[model samples]
Target: MTVTESAQKPEAPANEEQPVVYKSNLEDFEREADVRLPFLLSYREVKLLGIAGVGFFLDAYDLFIINPVATMLQYRLYGGNELPANLEGFVKAGANIGSVIGQFAFGYSADYFGRKAVYGKELMLIIFATIGSICDPTGAISPSGSLIWLGVWRIILGIGIGGDYPMSASVATDRANLRRRGTLLSYIFANQGWGSFVGSLATIIVLLCYKHTMEVDGHTSKVDGVWRILVGLSLIPAFGTLYQRLTLPESTRYAEAQKAAQRVQDEESIEQLKKKANADPGVSEKTKHSSDEEGSGTQTPTVETATAESQSVKAAKELAHAKKGHFKEFFAYFSEWRHLKVLLGTCVCWFLLDIAFYGVNLNQNVVLQQMGFDGSEGTPWNRLFKIGIGNLIITALGFVPGYYATILTIEKLGRKWIQIQGFLMAALFLGILAGKFYTLNTPSFIVCFAFLQFFFNFGANTTTYCYPAEVFPTRFRASAHGMSAACGKAGAIISALAFNSLTKSIGTPAVLWIFVGCCIFGAAFTLLLPEVRDRDPDVVYEQELRERERARH
Candidate 1:
């Protein structure tokens, strides 16, 4: 038997004497889905994961790769001079701005339309915009103009990357078995670390390939190709996964919900028609007899025709009600304080995490400089190689391992505990860095920095993504995840735009102090979220509906 087939719960034999339990259709469907899907990874599940995960890989690559690309641009476009601080901030922040917009727009679209409708379109956007960014017209435009061109394309790329947040998270969460949902999501998110590592590795390899040619005649002309090629390589995975995303089926939960809603609408429509027919004084005996025969299929031809017409009218009314209820039901469902609190917790925690997360990520080179890996005294190629090695070491020591640790332990430790510990530990390390900024030697700094990266991934970063996807009901899961993610990106934008100037004004130590505070607050906010390990979100949603119904009565 297939995994899905083997996972199914055996049905009890029906007995005429025993009355059947009248379960709500939605609840019944949820129960069936829960039984049919298992936590074990089948070939099909892995394929789905890879296809969904490619976007996150690109997101990480496109976002972090800019660091090296920006350095290369400094050489190729500005004659080896650093970009002006303001332009540099804008260029770094452009994609984040686009991401904020995409998250809000795409999140709502996924909830309002269907997940399948919006899944792969964002990947296509990423492919197009990534190509546009790499092909920035350096020769045809002034240096500043070239920067602007790349920034514009990066923003477009950010939008697509942003869409991937909700699309992938929702798709993965919707299909995952309860026992392995967190693990599967962590697996998908772990791709971000890999993407970052690969971006660094790719830059190093490409720089080496062109180092000799660019060094000749003291001209660094070939260095320009390094960033372009790095950015261009992301397109390969994007294209490869596009067909899978486009062809993937809509989530079973969503399909079942629609069916349940239609069944309810049909029942209500038939009941209302019965009441109207009973109350009408002008109804003739013949008309009454025909109405009674509608179900039995023993009516005359004219009566049969009238019954068919009535059924069509009911169908039209049902469709209208479904359309009207779409937005109304969303607002009404979330208006309850209990539901809204989950959203608030997710958004706030994510926001707090990103402020520190992006601040450190986007400005990691500054941290590396403090460790004496700045390569200031070396040739351009030597400098690039050192930077790549530093990044690779950082990823190896911290980012990649942290993500895998979360994957291995997430199901066991519980998301809340891991997130809380991650935040507190991250804060502790940040405090160490802040207090010992100048006093610490190179090895000490690397140790602290590596620990911070490790906890950040193992803690809030992975949990934040996993929680929002799992906590919300299917009707609003995508939208809620999007809003939370968008809020996080907003924090990233603030960090990116303000970090450079903030560092200049208050020094790096003071900035590290601020990040430490953010991490603390992130941990505090995480307390507001419930621990959701191994729980089916649909089951929780059904319980909530029962409670709401009970309160009304």
Candidate 2:
């Protein structure tokens, strides 16, 4: 019976625990979900963020820890000679390369396979790779061999690391309500700041462990233990989330959308059956007319069709679902210029942001030295310790705070404006630093650098991560976000490989100018993105599909 018609008939027993049964109509349910997601915040949301966010925390820890780890490696492995230029570049860029692979691979997998099936597998790769990395027999191998060993395992670890980008983003975005979508995403992305802070803090604490030896021997070989410990600590958070990531239930939003897709599937199947029955020579004209009614594009599930489920039909449906809903669907959705442009914008913006972001960040030691915290004039332990202090100062004053600032302000200011102003402000600082590279005194340069860090997080860095998760439809969200993020990693890879060489060839001032150019162009691309506040990609996609159908009629 129709839900409204049955409503007046009778009531169920009050003693029984009951389903809410509010909206039998799928369209009404979708509408309510859009409103309810933002308003609904509870333990479930917190638990999800807590689990999914670990990947990001690990991401920041591993990515930044390398800074100190590399310094430690310098003393422990090379007796403080600068690492081979090629090996240093590979070590820095390797994880990012793996991230690109993981982003593309997992992004597509989550969308096609459903979030739950593919969710925790990336963590497995991370665990395996992390273990492999720490076990790199540095004492037994040649310097080149040790570097290769570390680089290789990091790349493997990176695959899992990179995969987490799309996997976590999709999981968060899929579960998030429309009202607080930006805030929810920002909370997750902000973990990177803490991850970075913890990495710095960890270095200080670990370095202190062998302070006596460091001071006595200057550049003692015992420093080998330090990098391994930092790399291994990431495993603690990784293991904490592995069980939860594996056990994650399918997203409620994704489940509801699947119901809608199945309803459409049933309507198609019933139409096909009607057409075949009518084509029989013995079939009457009335049956043919009924077939036409069935083919009239009615989307809501009818009582007969909804009840038509049987073991055999379900078996076919499952098989058909597996075969049909893959790449062609993704392609059909993005075939139009309007949709294509958004995907393009996300990719381009993220790519540009990472180019500048990584370019500036990876060169922190250079900036730290300019601020007069250089470890160059000291003993081995003192030199490494001085740079660690520099890293700690930068992380405290700028990097961590900027992310939290975006979290507080993003929902109010809207993503587009924040990204625009962030880019403009960041460009302003980089331009000042680049223009006054030689002339600026210590305090002034640090001020400009700190503000630059502030604006990157407050503006594009956090927002770029948010946009991909928000801008695309559910079925395509993971894949699109993955592609966008992978492109960003590609930018990082280029910068990692080239920045040091570029700094040497053209000079640091010229390199900062290039970053300024990247940041300014990044702002221009921000215009291509929608505000994403109060909007639901799936809800909007449904509306557009209906509008197109109406126009066709």
Candidate 3:
């Protein structure tokens, strides 16, 4: 019924400078953190998911909502004219640009400081950015100025979106029991599908509520309410999650890593004190003999002084290391070929996956047109309604189902297998879609697009997310994941900026072929990763380091 998480120091303290809890038996704490909590579906596990999961839900919502919002904006600002191509690219890619910054900054911060220290700060950034985005003063600004305004706010919004990648991944992996680590990570990420689906659903529902208005006034200014309301809806969840995120407990594994570090420093201080204490053997022996003869024994002043000096030396070293600790640790860990290659693999694969994934996604309206579901030949309300309805069907048919497929099969099939197959299958579909681009009828194109989405969710898209968080040791986990995620976002920025222009120049079929190539390369890069199921990276890293030291000796 209840799984008592053998408590490590409670993560939320009343104040920032509260005393550190020192546990001397670091191994026992390690076992407690890495081994026990995963034994069952406890309330603590649920609470952790709720707190971490909400931000990811927001991640997808904030990022993808822009698509529909952009469509609605055409009506609101341009009176149903096509959105300016340059502005459209900027508006869509802005969040991703900010995300790259957030991913790198927050990823390093999470690992370098502590998850506890920085957990909610990114969410705080997100809330502010979201507000800034929805509150764009369209009336005060020209259409072009308004687009620039939304673009700027979304860049800020992207930072929060980007930060969540590493923050949530590291938090989930550090605490997950090896048995269900993949499952836990998948479930947290699966919130994205819901975010995507719900964004469209809300657009539809809210637009319907204004059915009479849009119908009465074609290309009406009232469309402004639809986009703004959709953007604003995400705020409710953000506000609801703020108190919990700010106060949620730090990952137990992270806490254990900290304690282990303290223990090593303490041990070194003791060792240094002993070396200094015996420096003058004659004086120390004489003092010891005199104390024994007096029926009592005590440390000589020299010994006490040596101990104080050693403690002070440790303190000073700690302070200096604190200045550049995480920076040093990050570079040192990834410096070796063995470690560096793995990081590269995750980065390369994620980078490739995003290029294709976001390319298709950012231009979904184009795809919908290819499938005859674009609602282009309709009244004003009818056009918006058709777009909304098409999004709902497409998202429902592909996005959520694909994610669920991975969740169900990930443990048995393994992350590497799923990822490789997912990439290959997606490439295959993209190839078919490219070949049949003009030839295919509506039903055929829908089938290809749906299956492409399916494999993407089931393969590299979800697994790209899981791999980095699980494969790196605690010391570099956040930074590495952030780096990988940043690379992926960089790819997204590429596609977001280029997809429209690329399709215009080369045609959508050629663009589909390019995505096919990206997917094929994605599968190739996926080959670089080892199977991470049922293993802990920290233990593997320590073991490898020890073996290397022995070999060097």
Deviation from native of the Cα of residue 240 in model 3, angstroms? 1.4
Instruction: Provide the TM-score for each candidate, comma-separated.
Output: 0.87, 0.86, 0.85
Predicted candidate 3 versus true structure: per-residue lDDT over 1-553, tens digit per residue = 2222332444545763333342223345455544543323445567667767887788788767888788888888887898998898899889899999999999988987787778888888988988888889998989999999999988988898889989988877776666678887888888899999988889889988998887875537888888888998998888887787777666666755555455444555565655665887775686567658655324446556657777657654653454354575568778988888899999999999999999989888888888666878887788888888888888898999999899888888999999999999999999999998889888888888899999999999999999999899776889899999999999999988888778889898898899999998888877778999987776686566546546644
What range of 10 consecutive residues in model 3 has the weakest lDDT sum? 1-10
lDDT for residue 162 in candidate 3, whole number 0-100: 89
RMSD of each: 5.3, 7.0, 6.8
Q: Per-residue lDDT for 3 in model 1?
A: 14
Error of 3 at 352 (Å): 0.2
Clashing residue pairs found in predicted model 1: none
Looking at candidate 2, the ten consecutive residues that score lowest on lDDT are 1-10
lDDT, candidate 1, 1-553, per-residue tens: 1112111222333852232121222344345545653334556557767988998899888778888888888888887788977778778898899999889889888876777788889998998898898888898999889888988988998999999999899888777656677988998999999999888889888887887787665668677888888989998899888888888767766544444355545665666766676787555455667767875665558656767777657645544555455676678867988888888899999999999999999998888898787767677777777888888888888999899889888888999999999999999999999999999999999999999999999999999999999888776788899999999999999898888888999999999899999999999988888989866665566566556546644
Local error of candidate 3 at 239, Å? Answer: 1.2
TM-score of 1: 0.87
The global C-alpha lDDT for each of the candidates, from Candidate 1 onward, is: 0.81, 0.81, 0.81
